[model samples]
Every structure is written in structure tokens, then in C-alpha cells.
Target chain A: MGLKIIVLAKQVPDTRNVGKDAMKADGTVNRAALAAIFNPEDLNALEQALRLKDRYPGSEITILTMGPGRAADIIREGLYRGADKGYLLTDRAFAGSDTLATSYAIACAIRKIKHFDLIVAGRQAIDGDTAQVGPQVAEKLNLPQITYAETVKSAEGGKITVVRRLERGVETVEAPLPCVITVNASAPDCRPRNAKRVMKFKHAKTVTESQAQSEDYIDLTNDRPYLNIEEWSVNDIETDMKWLGLGGSPTKVKKIENVVFQAKESKRITNNEEELEAMIVELIENHTIG
Target chain B: MGNLFVICEIEEGKIADVSLELLTKGRSLANDLSCKLEAVVLGHQLKGIEKQVFPFGVDVLHLADSKDLEIYTTLPFTAVIVDLFKQEKPEICLLGATTLGRDLGPRISSALQSGLTADCTSLEIGDHEDKKAGKTYKNLLYQIRPAFGGNIVATIINPDCRPQMATVREGVMKMEVYNENHKGKVKTIDVDKLLKPEDLVVKVIERHMEKSKVNIKNSSIIVAGGYGMGSREGFNQLFQLAEVLSAEVGASRAAVDAGYADHERQIGQTGVTVRPKLYIACGISGQIQHTAGMEESAMVIAINNDSNAPINKIADYVINGEVNDIVAKLIKLYKKNSK
Candidate 1:
């Protein structure tokens, strides 16, 4: 039997080339300044699922992302690759969630799926760098978690072998199937969008995204169910109100201070051999480096 | 609930450096909150190791010594700690953001229905306001960390959650041994009751512990490279200088992302936070993401072709030259001077 996989993806702002206006005066992120893209590491996780699907032939890949209504774009982006179906967990109730609340919301969504052989997630999001959500979801769901997974060696006889990248070196471990795996950036890069797949999924949109547009999707979704990226609000998922959003999120932003590094004066050093030698002697004498 | 607690990790019959660092930080925060600074140590036969926490200002040390608690497994350790936290109800909890801490911190926080902030760079005991709830919180743990890929800093607080928790990055705080002798409360809780047999679900078949040649975190000197190095082969130059100085080789995330170096050697917000005495930046453009990792170094030397590279701002000595040329000259000079 082919395995069922769920790839957890997030739409995060590209933070590599942040400019001056990246943060507003009040300390919250100025979303408009930075373009939101599929979180880079999530792509790596998706690649792992896609690779497994390739091996298992009939395996299915689903993308589950929790964010604002606009996060439906990540689902479409995943579909453009090789994902079969997508679930967008959205609602205003999920605002200001820390990793704990985020994982709770995600675990509930996974519960709704009911049956899956594996759940793949990025090791951490660049925005938070917490690396807690995937493992926490595993814990909340009472599933075994293999984190920092660089490669999935094999999945046979209801057992999965994964090679993990640790601080000192690589480690190979095996856990029974239906476990959670968090991918690291060291994993294989995800394949680019397929021309044909993009054309097929370009019109794929969540209900909210389709509602925002003037185009009518009533007939399209009825004819081609794949064009509909299913959306699940808090009400759709059986979630307690106390554990959904800001009230459930214990961590709060106390304050934010803008920091700018002031340039320190440095003595001009020439690159000549003589000056370089003299500077080395001086540094050695001062015990800077020997 | 007013007391602050630190989860002290033991390695090789002694407390890990990160645990000591958190103890030192916890002492300051405890002083600010006017409560006792307590420490919890769980391990097998942790007899004499519990005393070392006293000099660092731990008013109480709780040792849950057990054979099951050894080897740093997530199950029993989280069980014992969460059991203790439930009974003690500490106002704040701190641990090192290492592999064990990252795993245990979340489990405990999630189990208790509290909030946890990971990889914090700084901590303060202060007050905060809830903007949306229209309320004010007093005497909270202000956990500050890099957000948005180190582009901005956000101060997170667990205002509504009890026992606010945070995992601080290793080496971000100083670990100093106080010479003065002082008496502190040391309690050994019964471990058998805290850890349940059912909690052990995972088993380790084998653990390959390789001793890396470059223990960058403890190294006094570091030679760091960035994307400016161009390719993985360019890292050989950094390794050469590191070999000469007996230093560790490090890289920015850009280099790691570009497949130029392994992720373990990455030094930045998402990687290791090192405070080496001498840090030589080769071709590192020094975005805040990279510098935030090594900015605490005693001496920083930047060698980049661009004179206005961001690394130059924090560098004590800025050399406006190519890394290949400057590194060659420096290595030659050092070899010659030694001879």
C-alpha cells in the first residue's frame, strides 16, 4: 500500500534582504515591505514527501498550512509542484500564536485528516527560528518525531529510517511509520515548478482567495475538485476556544528597541607584505593571536 | 511562584557550561524579582555536581537523581521537570537552548499549557502591556531574541501564562565561579514517583558521538567566512588560518545555504552563538544575522574587498582587501614570524 504524507508549509516574508522599513515604528513587521514567499526549508520538506511519492507511485501528498487567507498561495504553490490536495487552516482566531498555539492548531488540523503515514515539516521557520512546532505537534499528537532529517533512507515494513544532521555529525536512526520528520536545509533542494503542473494548478484557489476575486468558481470547483484548496476555520476543526489564539498564546511582546551598530574607528592597515608582517608581530606580542 | 528555576544539565560528571551560564543569568533575574534562584538537576548519581550551582547564586538546588534520568532522553527528563514545575509553580524557568533544552522546553511548556520562548539572546525582569487585551502585566520575564532572520529584535514575555519559560542560547552570558562560600538549600526529590514507566516510548539503538576536531563554541579564536568566499572550496582558506591559530572555523548562514559549508559550523542567529576572543572575518559581509552570533567577541578583524562591508562597522581592524590575498599574506607572515 502506498503511504500517505502531509507536508507542513508556511508563507513567510523573505527576511534575507530586509531594508530599513522592514519593521514599523510600533515594532510589528511591516508586511508590505517584504514579499511573502514559501518558507525555504518547507520546500525541502515538500521535496522529501515528493521523493517518497515518486518511490511509492500511488502515494498521495497533501500540503497543510496555517496562516491568513492569503496563505492559500502556499497551497497552490505546493500543488504546482506535485501535491495532490491542500488544506489551508485559517481564521482570525489564529492571530498572534506562538509555537505552542501554532502547533496546537496544526495538530488539530492533522487530527482532522484522520489517517496519514507520515508528517513532514521544516526544522524551523526562519521568521521564528524556534524549531519547536514540528516536535511539539508530534508530542501533542503522541507520535514519534525524527528531527533534523537530512534524508529518508527507507520506509519498509512499517519502519522508516532517517539520517539526521546533528551538531557534531550525522546520525542514522529508525522509527516506526506514522512518525513526524522535520527536514533541515541540508536536505535536497526542492524541484522547481513544473510547466504543466503550474498550468493545471494556476487557477487553484482557496474559497477565501476565490471570494476575493470577481471570477466565478462555482462551476469550476464542481467540475474539477482539485481546483479547490479546502479552507478550515476554527469552527470547522473541533477546537476549544481557550486554546486557539492570543488568549491561548502565553508569550507576549514586551518591548522592541531598534538597534543600529555604530562604526568603530580602525587604524588603516595596508596589504603590503612588510606591513602585514609587522601587524602580525604586534598582534602576537599583544597576545591577540599566537 | 515568585522563584526562578533553571534546568541544569550535567555532562561528564560536571554541569554543562550552558547550565552555568543560565544559572548566572538566573541569579541576576532572581535578584531583580526579589526571589530565590533555584536550580533543578536530574541525572544518574549526580552526587557532588549539585553543589557547584551554589556559588553561582542558586538559592535552592533540586536534584532528582535517578538512573532513568541519565543520558539526556526527552521522556523521563520532561516527566521529572514537568512534575516538579507543576508542584513548585515557579514564576520563571530558564534552560540552555541546546539539543536537550530545545526538546524538553517545549514539551514541558506544552504539557503545562504555558508559553515558551526559545533561543533567547537576552533576558530581563520587567513589566509589559497587553495591547489587544487592554491590560498591563508586571514583573515578567522579558525574553529578547532575534526575529525575522535577525533583521529585528523582539522582546517576548509570557504575561498571562504562569511560569514564563525561555531557552537562552549557549555562550550568550558569562559563566563565572564565585570564590566566596555560601550556604544554599539543596533538596533531593524522589525520582521514582516523578518519572512514569509509560512515558518511555522511544529507544536508542545506537548513538554515534564523534569528537569534532574544532569545538568552535569553546575555541578562543575563530576564522569565519561568508558568501563572499564564493564556493565550498573557498572554505579551505579559512581552515588554513584556523589551523595556524588553533582556532575554529565558522561560516555565515549564506555560506551554509549556498552549500559552501555544513550547517553545524554556521554562526549566526539560527546557528551557534560564539564569543571567541579573536574573530577574523574573511569575505564576510556581516549582516546582522551573521554578526549577532559573534559580535560579542573581544577582537574582530574583517578582511573584505568592499571597504564599506557591514562587518567593518563592528570590526576592530578592517582590512579593505580581497580575502584570498589578505589571508595568504597573514598566514605567510605568521608562519615566517614563528620560524
Candidate 2:
């Protein structure tokens, strides 16, 4: 058995370049104004995990994501990129989940599944950038954790070796099995979606969900719905309701305001030799250039 | 009154410089809050760290010395800190936003069920009526960080959570005061074998440390190129200029994505946030993401063919020209002036 690795992925809005109309009157992000894409760094994490699978052949890569129905796009992306299997954890109860609550649900789902040799996640989700979920999951799962991993040097004989990017430099550490690693952007770029693999797994889905999608729109009646992903609700996860959602999230947004730059043109010096020298001298005197 | 806690970190038995930086910030916060400063050191039979904390203005040193705690693990670090948080209940907890602190802070806060704000640039104590109580004077710690990709500054407060938490980026603050008269107490905590060898899912098999070629975060001068550089060859010119000037090379988000250089050299909201003395942007349009990271630099010189670009708006000197020509000229000029 080569290593079995699982990657937890997320689909987030591209908030880096939002327009003036990106915010609604109620002061919440207008999801419509933003285009949804797989979180960029999460793709890096997925790529790192897939690279591990490639090195040690026979290793199976599983992708688990918790998002809305449309998040199935990420699963398609994952499958296209050589993930052996993709599982979606979707339900209405998981809506409005903060990092803590979301990590709880994912941990429960992971606990329900079979054991894996390793788990990987992006350093942080762009939407929140809390960077809390990965470590929190490791803590909840009782696994050793390493965040900001740029490269995985080796993994063999129940031992995993990786390079950790610290502020000043990089530190190489080898941790025991079943460790959770958070992939930083410094890692290798994720490979492009493989065309042949996409075609092969195009039809793959949970048995019931595939059948439901196969049904015609008119034939859909007031009948029982399908349980697609073995998704557990807040109760199904054996979680306290008080420890979920906005109620559980201690941080509150008193206000959400768009930051506007008050452009103050201090002094625009020319790039001439004298002017450049003078500007540098003045900046140092003002303690701005230092 | 609780003392400010500064967690000391060491790699290969050498004290990390950022630990000293945190102690400096902690001492100031302690003075503002009218409390003493404390340093928390955890490692394997490390007794030398105690003497060092004194120069850093630590009034009390909490030591957790053990063999199992040699390498940083989530369980031991969290377990030890949670115990300290319960016993001490410090007013503020600050950690360097390094790899270890990023991994450890959240778990500790989650275990304590407290609020933690990560990657903060500034902090202060705010005197306001307790929002929870509506009309009671309370000293709430205000943790401020650049959010929305450094376009906005968000001030976060943990009014209810004890030990209001925040992580500061390395090199963003000063080092602690090294006063010879600084006297404090050192209390050693026992990290008993609460965790088993089997419980650790991940084991350290081997370790490697690669010395970085360029420590951009600590560099005083940075020469950044962007997509407007026109070609990959043009970016190479910027690098040549960086070599001549003894400056770190940087790029905008588009430039990095375009394969001009590695992602580590990219400077912007998504990349490294930097504030160098002289930041020169060549052939780059100033998008918000790119601007957010470099806007804080002391003197920004934007060289772009298009004078109306946003880079021109924020730059102290807007060189309206082609980047390749301008960079080549600047290199020639610098060489001549140096002689």
C-alpha cells in the first residue's frame, strides 16, 4: 500500500479584484459581482498531494469538499487532475458556517471515513484568510501538523519529510505518519486538468446523485430526495448546535466598510540625478526612507 | 494585573530574532496597560533562554523544559500554553506569524475557545464601554491588521475572550530593550507524558535547512518590475539593476503569473507584504493588489510608459518612459556615479 492522501478543497469568490459594486447595501459581499473559482492556493495544495501520489505509484488520491451544489465544479476539476475519487459534503445545515464550525463538520466526515496516511490543505482560504482550519483539523484529529509547507522532500516507511518556509528562511523537518500539511503558494503550481482523465471520470458520482441527475426535469415529482454524499447534518456530526455558525463564531463584524485611498500628492520629483539624490536624502531625514 | 506574554522561539538552539522583536512590542504594550512583561520559553532542557529574557524586559519567565517538547508539536505546545493562559490570563498574546506560530496559535485559541486575530501590523488598548455590558468602562485590547489585501486596516477586538490574540509579521517591529537591571522570575512547568508516541500521527524523520539567497522582508531597498516590463528579457534587466544596486528584486502579481520569476519574488496583496526604503516599479501598472504591498515603501519611483497608470498616482517619482530603456539608463547612471 503506497500512501493514501486526502485533500480538503474550497471554492471561493475572487475577492482580490472586486469592483465598487462588489458590496451590497446591507454591507455584505455581493457574491454575484464576484466570479467563483477554486481557491488558488488550495489548487496548489491539491497539486502537492497529487505529486506525492505520482512519486509513490499505487497511491490513491481522494478529494473532499464542503460547499454548495455548484461546488461540484471543484470535484470535476479535482477528478480531471487525477484525483482517484471526489466526495462532496453538501447540505443546508452547513450553510453560514464559520471556520470553527466548518472544520468541525469536515473532521466528523474525515473521522467517518477510513484512515489515510496524510491530509493536506491550503494555508488559508482567501475569503477569510484566517488560516485556522488546517491546524484546527489536525488538532481535532490528533495528528501532527505542519503549516506553510513549500515542498515535500520525501515520504517513506511511515515517515514524511517536508521543507517548512519560515519568515527568515526554510527549515526541513521530518514528521511521523498521518501528519496534516498546509500547502503555501510557494509550492509548485498545480498541473493543468488532464483531458483524458476528465472524460474517463465524467460519469463518476455518488450512485444516488448520478441517478438523480439522470432523471428528466418533468419526471421529477414530489417524491423522496436522494442522499448524495453521506452528508451529516450538525446533529449527524454529534456537534453541539451552540458551537456552530454565527452563534459559535466569537468574532463579530461591527461594520464592513470599503477602504478608499485619500490620494495626497506629497512631492513628485523627477528622476534626474540631483533630484533623485535630494529625494533620497530628504526621505532619510524624515525617517521615511530608512 | 496580568503581564504581557512574549513566546520565545529558537531554531537549532539559537534564539530567533523575531522573538526579540515581539518582546519589544510586548514591553510597550505592558507599559500602556500598566503591567509587567513576561516571556514563555519551551524546549528540551533549555536553561540558557532564561538569562536572555531578562535583557528583553521580561519580569517573569515561564519555562516548559522537556525532551518530548524539543521539536514543536501541537499537543505539547497547546497543552502547555492553555495551562498558562488559564493560570496567567494575560491581557494580550502576540506571536510571530512564522510557520510555527501560524500552526500553534489557532489550536491553542480554539482549545481555550478564545478569539485570535492573525497577521496583525499594529496593536493598542482601547478604552470604551463594554459592548457586552452596554455601560461599563473596560480596557479592551484592539488588534489592528491590514485586511482586504492591505487596502483597508481592520481593528479587531476580543471584548469577551481572554488573552486577546494577534500575530505580527517578522521585521515589522523593533527589538526589545536590553536593560541590564531588568529582573524577573523564572517558573518552570512540567510537560508530563500526557501524549503517547503512537498518538503522534506525524513523526519527524529528518530535517533540512536551506539558507535563503535573498531575505526580501529585511531588505532596505527593493527594485520591482511588472508586466509593463514588456518582455521576460526586460525583467532580467531589472534583476541586473538589483544586482548592481545591492537591492532585492520584486515583481507585481501579473509579472509573477506571467513566468517572469518565481512566486516568492512577487510583491502584492497575495504575495509578500513589503516596506522597503526605495521601491522602484518598472513597467508596471499599479493595481490594488500590487499597490497594497508596496504603497508603504518610503520612496516609490514608478517608471511606466503610460503616465496615467495608478502607479503614477502613488509614486513619489513618476518616470514616464519605457522600463527597459529607463532601467538600462539608471544602471548606467548608477555605475558612473559610484565611480
Q: Which candidate number maximizes lDDT?
A: 1
Q: What are the Cα lDDT values of the candidates?
A: 0.84, 0.74
**Model 1 CA lDDT for position B101:** 82
Q: Worst 10-residue stretch by lDDT in candidate 2 chain A?
A: A218-227
DockQ of each: 0.56, 0.33
Top candidate, metric DockQ: 1
Q: What TM-score does chain A of each model score against the native chain A?
A: 0.92, 0.81
Model 1 ranges with Cα > 4 A deviation = A19-30, A153-161, A169-177, A212-217, A270-278, B129-136, B183-186, B194-197, B336-339
lDDT at position A30, candidate 2: 72
What are the per-residue Cα lDDT tens digits for candidate 2 across B55-135?
878889888888777877666778788888898988778887776787888887777776777776667777655466576
TM-score of chain B of each: 0.93, 0.87
Per-residue CA lDDT of candidate 1, range B39-68, in tens? 999888887875688889888899898877
User: Alpha-carbon error at A102 in model 1, in Å?
Assistant: 1.7
Q: Lowest summed lDDT over 10 consecutive residues: which window, candidate 2 chain B? A: B194-203
How large an RMSD does model 1 have?
2.8
